[model samples]
Target: MHPALSIIVFTTLSGLGYGLATALGTGLLDPAATATKAAHLLALALIAAGLMSSTLHLGNPQRAWRAFSQWRSSWLSREGVMAVLTFLPLAASAFLAIFESRYEPALGLAGAALSLVTVYCTAMIYASLKSVQTWHTPLTPLCYLLFALAGGFSLSTFFAAMGGGNLLLSSGLAAFFVCLAWIAKLVWRNRMNTLRPISTPETATGLGFIGKVRLFERPHINDNYLTNEMGFRVARKHAVKLAALSFGLGGIVPVALLLGLLALGAAHPAVAVGVALLAVLSHITGMLVERWLFFAEARHAVMNYYGG
Candidate 1:
């Protein structure tokens, strides 16, 4: 359950990159349109960078070629397949956009749709794991997709504000997504808080004892891989604090800044870009901690042996 930075960066980066690509493919990018080309390009770059980081997390990077072999049964395989396939439409559409082809918008739409599927596949990689009861829910994938888009769109807003002094669209998008992500997060957290493990010490031991069974007559003196891996625990009060910080820094602050800039008609490049970066950084940081707590907070089936 130890949080790995490589995994964290991989997830966070891919989430942001592909998420932004999702919106861009949906006509968010128009050379002759409202948004800027620079924003679109920046998003594409980030997406590529994120995917690269994610790929680096594999144990045998060379054997990563085999990842796409079992899409029928594996979410990770599906994610790998979908993530790679997303690039075809993205490249074609981006090419048309840059070349000013009449068919660019259509291509962009196709890519956007595929990008969304890619994100869903990535989310499902975690949600489909039935062993992790805390993550075994429809909301898990839904939350992942929503947060990625929220993060992507927020990054786009910053890029757009820098290129064109328009705060209205990004602000509106940020505010709306903040509310949606918050609600989804709260729903997941509350559901997790109420759920109890289905296993017990007796079940693990097959003693069939009917009376009160405790995990320890004597305390555990040695820490092993199981305890180190699955014994991670989080304090409720600290979790609340982290959630509050995430809501404020990741959710509230960026929207407030955008709104403020809009009100004053002062969407300077620096301010807009700064806010956008801040939003991306804060949101990703919060999600990182959230993901950490997510793994740490879950009580594993093996814990029944320890009377957890």
Candidate 2:
């Protein structure tokens, strides 16, 4: 449950990338505009950067290619396979937008669908892990999808404010998605806080019937791989503070700014652009904290043996 910097960056950046890809597929912007070109490039850049960061978490980055071969059984494999397949259509769509200044419905839509599916696959990588009770839930994928949509919409609002499309509508949609994402996140937090341990030392050792179980001594004199990776702990107080920051910055503040942008109604393009920029920055920062807490707080079932 250690929060690896590489994985955190991978998830956040890729979510935003896929979200933007989804929006672009809807033909939301004028393909001929400079903003459209910039948006297309940015989307691909974000996705590529995220995918590359993910490789950093692997023990043998060169063997990452083998991951694609296990799509039938592994969520990670499915994610890898889908991520590669997604690029074909996304590249074609980007090429059309950048070079031809036109949107191809077939390619754009295909890329968009694949982008979402890829996100789902990424979520399933964690959601499918039964050993991590915090992550083993339907809500895991739901939260991931919603956060991606929210981030993507927020980024789209910035492009829209820059004159690539309808600023008012984009801001409104961004606000709505941010609100919805936070609501789902709030529920997730509540569940995590209230969850009873499905796995404890007694259950882990199959000794509950004998009576309460407790660790009589340390597993060893020194830490091992499992302790280093899965025995992480966070103070309840710090968690409360971080969760508040995540909600306020990632959710509340962005919504306020987005709604303000909606009210501005294209009256002041420069001000709207600045506000959108702030909203985007704040949301990204908030999401980073949330992701950090996500790993820091997770209780891996394997930790039971380590007296965690």
lDDT of 2 by residue, 1-308 (tens): 88889999999999999998888887888888888888999999999999999999888898888998988899999999999999999888889989999999988989889999999999999999999998888898889988988998899899987878777777887888899889988898889989998999999999999999888887688988888888777534498899899999999999999999988888899999899999999999999998888888889998888888
Question: Which whole-number lDDT from 0 to 100 does residue 256 have in model 1?
Answer: 70
| Cα displacement (Å) at residue 303, model 2 | 1.4
Worst 10-residue lDDT window for candidate 2 reads 228-237
TM-score of each: 0.85, 0.98
Candidate 2 Cα errors over 4 Å, as ranges: 235-237
Inter-residue clash pairs, candidate 2: none
Question: Residue-pair clashes per candidate, as listed?
Answer: 1, 0
Question: Any runs in candidate 1 off by more than 4 Å, and if so which?
Answer: 32-36, 98-103, 164-166, 217-225, 234-237, 265-270, 306-308
lDDT of 2 at 185: 87
lDDT of 1 by residue, 137-221 (tens): 8998777778777877776666566653345666567667766877898899899889876666777777756766676542557
